[model samples]
Target: MNILVLKMGGSILAKLPTSFYQTIVALKQQKICEPIIVHGGGPEINETLKELHVESKFVDGLRVTTNEVLDVAEMVMSGSINKKIVANIQKQGGTAIGMSGVDGKTLQAIPIDNASTLGYVGQVKKVNVSWIEQIMEHGAIPVISPIGIDGSGERLNINGDMAAAAVAKALKAKLALISDIPGVMENVSGKEFVHEQLTKEEIEEKIASGVIYGGMIPKVRSALNGLSGGIKESVILNGLAPEDIKDYIQGKQAGTKVVMKKEEKQHV
Candidate 1:
């Protein structure tokens, strides 16, 4: 039951300096039970689409996916990003296993209805997280790729944040999102930080006011969902600073907290 689900976006993955092998090597020394990673390949997907002469469009902040786009998504996400992280962990003397959300029926989903044409994009409908425990039991890290399957056995491109949330809830874990920015900020500029803990509703208010929009919205919403669904707590932290991981894990305060329910908002 001592597990932390860490979700890192492709932005962070692509930004890893020199290589992430050393970081993973360092992390091996810091044993805090099991850590599972779920990752997205956003920038890589966009770049690949451009190379293939595919135009990109968004409907209400969600990507407008077509069958062609879905192929590219799977290639970049499950093929490139997923394998890369697994290799990094392996080179660091850690046992690493890469899997798409489809592997072993680990993740199942339904459509996200943002638009009728957003083909192949899905909202997480279920997560079978026994793989996480099984991997850790064998001394390996489960490095999840954000690709899922539906009831009809069709593939889906699940959002990494939602994917992580669902997996954390399934595993009954503490969710930690690793991002480029420092956690959620009340002010539009991340410079004005909200260092204290916050509630789901308060975070939603920030999203509505435009203080946090764009990508942060999905990340924040995932954190809230994780807590509401029985995961212990969820945090958004600067993955660039891996040293802070210990502090956040013990709830000593390092990132923006979104696990608190709406009723607890007044207390903060």
Candidate 2:
């Protein structure tokens, strides 16, 4: 089966229409592609932390995850947001199972900085592909939360994008990054237009020329990192326009496809 790993950010989850979930169910029912969802809960986590009087800190965009912060993150991501997504999919008449990386040791990880600087922040070192495949074969969508397990049996906070990329690489699946915007946009002359596809070279040029700046730079860099990490394909799709999901699956023009090299564009 062609597996499509859909990575949805917390900010866009509530804004996505019910049709989005419906489309996913339709795709699965039709056997178009097995849709595995990996989601983030940054906004919800922050809110919960504030409510619990926990101070949040960040170092270079990664949350400084003390044991207290890890508790809140896992509670929000694995407990709240994870089930919410499962319920939404079930509401759309689909069977969904929600789990965190710690479940079945799905995402085996190592701390990014030996748990010294970034606290419990870690990157995925390995993935349990068979576990996810078993879930998929059972005809259920697996909704994953980005909380990984370390070698010492401790749960570690993972970056959502990194977790999605690791799963995609392991499953040999296409990674679809669902965003609020259409895709990566570039300004030409004066007007701006979305690039239907971007290569590493082009992305670098855009970044250096200030075309891709601020928040987009990190997002594009993440896509590039995934490519380098063995993810076969990656695309940034607009979650707001859920119809694009089908369009993309049908090989129609949809979001911006990111590739490692220019020659790789033709095959996509």
Candidate 3:
């Protein structure tokens, strides 16, 4: 079965309409692709940290996970946010099981930097794809939290986009970086529009020109990483539209498809 890895951004999780969940169900029922979700919970974690008077910071688009911050991140991501996504899918009549990367050692990790600078932040060293395959075989979507485990059994914070890229590479699945926006946008003559397709060079140029800045930079970079890892294609698309997923499955252009080079065509 072909797999499609959907990377859900935390900023837009709560705002996602029921139509988005319906798309997941439709995909499964039609056997278009077996969908697996890896989600983020950044805004929620930051809110909780603020409530508890804990200082939070970021370095190079990754949250600086101090021990105190790690505790709250685990709670927000693996505990609350994980189950919330599962429940939302269930409410829309889709089967979903939520689990953290630490569960069954699905994601093994090593620190990205010394703990003195960024406490407990790690990159994925290994991914045990069996856990996801089992769920997929059972006709259920595995909604994964990006909290990884290190060698010493310590919980490590992972960037959700990075986690999704790693999982897609492991499964050799296509990737979609789902967010609230329609796609990569450009202000042409003061009117903004989604750029239906983009190559790595175009993405870099846009970033340098200030057209693609902030959160979108990390997303496109993650997409580039997935492409380099041999995933057929990666996309940045909105989850808000009712017909977006259907369009994608039908080979209709629905969002900004990322390619490694301009000469490359869109691949499955």
**Top model by lDDT, which number?**
2
Per-residue error for 207 in candidate 3, Å, reads 1.9
Candidate 1 vs candidate 2, TM-score winner: 2
What Cα-based lDDT does every candidate model obtain?
A: 0.77, 0.90, 0.87
Worst 10 residues of 2 by lDDT: 259-268
- Badly placed stretches (over 4 Å) of model 3 are 189-192, 228-232, 263-268
Error in Å for residue 29 of model 1 = 5.8
- Model 1 regions more than 4 Å off: 17-30, 186-194, 207-222, 225-232, 262-268
lDDT of 3 at 23: 89
lDDT of 3 at 45: 91
Q: Would you list the clashing residue pairs of candidate 3?
A: none
Root-mean-square deviation of each candidate, in angstroms? Answer: 3.7, 1.8, 2.3
* Clash counts for the predictions, in order: 0, 0, 0
**After TM-score superposition, what is the CA distance of residue 166 in candidate 2 from its true location, in Å?**
0.7
- Tell me the lDDT of model 2 at 244: 89
State in Å the error of residue 231, model 3: 3.3
| Model 1 lDDT at residue 140 | 81
lDDT at 163, model 3: 89
